[model samples]
Target: MATAVFPYLPADELKKAEDESNARELSWFLDNLQEKLAEFKHGLEDCYARLSPLEDPESSTLVISTPKSELVKGHVTRVGTRVVKGSLHLRLKTLPSLHLKLSETSPLILPQLSHLRTLLNNALDCVDITRWTGDRHSAAFITSQLHLLHSLLLEAQNVLTGPSFPVPRPGTPHPLPIASRTSGEDGNEHNPPWYQCIPDPNTFAPPVPENLSLHLIPTTSSLILTIRVLEPTAVPPSAFNKFALAIGAQRRLEHDEMDGVFMWKGEEVKVKEKVRVESGGDPVLLVLGVKLQSLEKGIEGAMMSLRAVMGLSQEKDDD
Candidate 1:
């Protein structure tokens, strides 16, 4: 068979490949819920830099936790892990009576807790991760959903106090900026011949937490990489500079060392990154790592959006 051109794979096949990969990855997370839970628990402790005993309050049992907000916050602890023998320092603001009762004496609710735990574990096991795809957009979607859920769970915990805080006053309803050309979904970075419009030099990323990572490994022909991140509300200024530098360096290397004339901003970065901002705050930064390489023989053309070729299918499937 002739050499296949990089980034020139057919659309249908690319989507299938990405779908399978996403399914497998998600399945892995589900299969080893305990391990993931452990990883998350350790991660939470590390990020929060606090040793508060897993915040178990009375009248309510802590079932599980996930990344709580845009900024990395909490995680779910799986049962069977060594529970520190000492008393946890969880203070219950909602019901001090219940809190004291539970802590002073382990409540009979252990059974209830165990039952809910079993139910949750089973639900995760049978979760229809089919709702997810291997595409960057799908990944972002899942990350966003998880983020929102985390926030809601925390809010619910606080609200159980029965209006301790002032009633929230109604405010102007601001519509989300999806309509603006300025704010686009991270997924649309690969719109074909128009892919130029997608953010190049842009990382294919979900919202990223501080602990999550984005890495790029350059190959003779293409880049290989892994990105584990949570979604961000907006891009930081330093992140923007890093993106500019990486794209510039890559372009210089291609031109100076490899005798290539590829378009860096045009092909390497998404057009959205170049979006002209007319107001508000600086745009939210989403980071993705790109691995680059030259196309091989056989294919007459090569097309790269703001993401890997395998990413094409992911984008489509997400839509």
Candidate 2:
């Protein structure tokens, strides 16, 4: 017989969990923000000609500073493609007041927008992998993105927030705890908030891209996935050179326990990230792949095996 587990947690205990989760999330965002700023600064220095259009002396930079509110906090916005040639513009807005728009050519904008989209998607993906089982962290992260994307969609055209895109919703309660909250000295309740792009259930499914393929399998504890990347014609040859997929597991070591191994008849396991970089300066793309496997054994053991495979593939790419 299977042992029974409680679904609803005690109110006090749930509150405590939320507090701890928020701290960790805030830390992750701060670290990523620093890295993003550095990359933007360096790109500006290296390609001034590519971003010249946005540097017009007549245009004034707009600032929309306001008190940090639940709906407007942690929002990031950027402008990639413009209306001209040989110029690129980038605008990053994390809050209502913080916004920048650079006027540049289409080529410059495309690459920058692509990179930014990758980063945003990667961040959300990390949150998805870590908070797969519903909790406050998952809600906070997803909520922030929804609000951010909604605001962007209102003013611009973003494929991710398009009608075809579907945002994952919380499911039945499990062992994982939901996000927590903290109280200020003045006794005000503070917790990360959730935002919806368009509250209607009808508009939730993500628009499918012609080249993107998704595979999902349900297991005893969690879901196993294999994502195959098909090269898009719009992406240049150089953009196809190096491809890396980063997997973030919620319970890093518990991966195996949740999804049992198919080959060994054991528990599921988290695979180590495998990065493949190609040789030669020419523009050739590879069929990139990401697979989450079951490892009856420990996490370290599985990663070692994956590293070996990646190394061998890299050698072949070089040859």
Candidate 3:
């Protein structure tokens, strides 16, 4: 009598209903999980991109606020093809600077920019979405992965602005040595041909033929100086060389033999004394100085020549 009142549903119908329910539940879970994951991933990607030197051709600036409301500012400027200038303005009064030049063997460990873009499109390749039922463990695992990604981004930033640049860690395997392992023709293992062991200067020095130029832009109350290589692509691995600037009758305004270039404010020009110029005569001369060893040929003074034209217009008294 009970069986007749409640007829049994067919096995196929029961199986179909169960599958449909599972599909709906899985879809809803994936939607929520993916949304969260995507938001986190986007934030990390943005941070990575902002700090990546390769992504920024002009410059990359990052300002991170601390818990104490202080700001730590950092910037990386591409000076040449192989050279990059970095500056960090910490909470302290003094600012630190870094000059990095990538060599042929240097490793740019920051992964390609597209790595995170496709992370979600194929992230589930090995993941079984059906098994993820919004369990606490599953959520925790996702969160861990996001944290790892964030850590990687932070590491990249540190590599750029850290006190020291990244170098190959010891114990890494090296290619086979070109020198003979056994004794040389001299029958001495210690004595190898100079050519075989001599380090190449080109490996660390600037290119043989270099072209550098300097220009000045005058503002309302300041002067902006810019130095750039004409052939940036040809520049080899090099350090931040020195520069000297002279204004008005070859008077040295600023000079540094070993340091990175910094933006010079007009007030910091440090003029020794005021020059007595003829009221209606030639303009003052501005000379761009360079080290003799840095260039093969002397740069034409005319190339960096700038005329400081100062004139006081006299008004006739109107009666």
| The best candidate in terms of TM-score | 3
Question: Looking at candidate 3, what is the lDDT of residue 291?
Answer: 16
Candidate 1 on 202-233: residue-level lDDT in tens?
A: 22222222323222111111211222222233
Candidate 2 least-lDDT 10 residues: 282-291
Ranked by TM-score from best down, the candidates are: 3, 1, 2
All candidates in order of lDDT, best leading? 3, 2, 1
Q: How would you encode candidate 3's per-residue C-alpha lDDT over 50-85 as one tens digit per residue?
A: 334353442322222223433333333221112233
Which residue ranges in model 1 land beyond 4 Å of their true spot? 1-8, 38-152, 159-162, 165-319
Query: Where in model 2 is the C-alpha error above 4 Å?
Result: 1-10, 51-319
Q: Write the residue-wise lDDT of candidate 2 on 265-300 in tens digits.
A: 122211211111111211100100001111112222
RMSD per candidate (Å) reads: 25.7, 28.1, 28.2
Off by over 4 Å in 3: 1-8, 54-319
Better of 1 and 2 by TM-score: 1
> For this target, which candidate reaches the highest lDDT against the unseen true structure?
3
